[model samples]
Target: MAAILKDVMSPNPVSSNATDELTTVSKKMKEEDVGFIPVKEDDKYAGVVTDRDIVVNGLAKGSAENVQASDVMTENIVTGPPDMEVEEAARLMQEHQIKRLLVMEDKEVKGVATLGDLGVENAVETAGNVIHDVSKGNGNN
Candidate 1:
């Protein structure tokens, strides 16, 4: 069976508003252990804010903490519906050089998918080699 984006997506990812303060956004990102957050404006997904963006743009530029999330988010985003095939997602991710994707259903936020979520474990000390190991019938990593 073809894998679906839902299988790899992180449901209900931590998100924030474009108008929210940078401090608030930082706290949410850190507390959630997420590198990115979906940004919304006028009740619609506006863009995404990434940890790198903060470091490169906000901190390096010395943007005040009072600055809004909108000021730092990357607006040019690529999104996919929940039922989108994993290959399509992978293709998109490869084409865009993105590690994550937002999953939507009926234009409503549903989940998020990241490359890490799709990776198989590599530990080799147990009764068997880790996931996706060739000996156990899982696909090669």
Candidate 2:
């Protein structure tokens, strides 16, 4: 199977505005069962924020409710086109040690892809032997 951004990217991923507070972002992440959310500016991609970012940059600094998502968002995002293969994306992610990738198409944000979303569906090996064994009924080995 060819790896493409469309096959992995989470379409319509949960998002927050740049002006949103860190506390608010945390709530959204919990409510949506997501570890991160994209930051947007009037429908334009701005940056991205993860749970760790909120904790380290906000709560750790005692500024959760006051800190804006933009302030702590990861601006040096490694994005990809929708047509890119999933294997290539995985390689990039591994080299950078990133868990998620912002998907872009025609210079616009289309979705986001986390390591789990891509490999889990295409190759169980992408998740390691633990997941593979679990999914395969833990055969007597």
How far is each candidate from the true structure, as Cα RMSD in Å? 8.7, 7.8
Residue pairs in clash, model 2: 3-85, 3-86, 4-86
* Number of clashes recorded per candidate: 0, 3
Clashing pairs in 1: none
On lDDT, the leading prediction is: 2
Please, what are the lDDT tens digits per residue for candidate 2 over residues 63-125?
A: 676789998887767888999898888877655556677888876778888778776444445
lDDT of model 2, residue 68 = 94
TM-score of 2: 0.79
Q: Residues 41-85, candidate 1, lDDT per residue (tens digit)?
A: 999988888776676567876765767889888888778888888
Give the TM-score of each candidate: 0.79, 0.79
TM-score between model 1 and native: 0.79
